[model samples]
Target: WRRGTNSIAVLGAPQVILYKFGHPSDAWWGVLPYWAGLLILSAPVGLTVYYFLNDHTPPKSTPLAAFLLSLAFISSCVWTDLIASELVSGLEFLGVSLGVSRSIIGLTILAWGNSIGDFVADTALARAGNPRMGAAGGFGGPLF
Candidate 1:
């Protein structure tokens, strides 16, 4: 049984790589590794954000404060989307220059990068033994 599984894995590996990276002549195999390194480098930045947001309960807010907070949230969302677009565009340009298709970039790089947070959260929930919650999160978290 183990040998059969290993044989299946060996047979499947090349197809998976082909689908992900395309023809060797046209593919940029370094993009995913570069992306992974970026992810690792950004971990500290994410931790810093969590540190800032974790423990502070907002004080009772006046109506003006509430309005300002809402405005700030909206502005931050806009800024985040703007920055994401620029980064994605730059990545897409790099992929095109390397002879990769836009669809491949969108499917692999963009999808994986954007979904990493949901993936991590779901994995953590599963590891914590609340697999139903993790399954639900896996199914539902991407809707937003």
Candidate 2:
């Protein structure tokens, strides 16, 4: 059970690079997750970020900082995928236990997850004889 939980925690199999940023002078650690692995992983990162943001304040923006920030932003996308996969897995298990059809469960979950507004708008547009526009709108609606 512990092994399974640990395996699932690293769902995306992210690369394990050991980045050792020097510690901050002042002692201030933010709220931490209730997991030893996370504590080990995030302590250095949180300290590094604190060191950069508070202590070594940048007067002018550097390209390296921009690139690092972009990578951090991109990590959110990975987190989203991880969270969504867990949600879907839980929903699937519930459906199976409840003796419900997986297809029906999928349809219900997907419709709500993707938003019924997208379905209605896309359908209306496609029915009104513009499928390309409908398809484009369907894909683009979530961006806004």
Q: Which candidate ranks first by TM-score, i.e. highest? A: 1
lDDT of residue 66 for candidate 1: 60
Candidate 2, residues 64-91, lDDT tens digits: the string is 3564455446556666766787898999
Every model's TM-score: 0.51, 0.44
Encode model 1's per-residue lDDT on 69-117: one tens digit a residue: 5544654565576678789999999999999999999999999998999
RMSD of each: 20.2, 12.4
> Model 2: clashing residue pairs?
none
Top candidate on lDDT is: 1
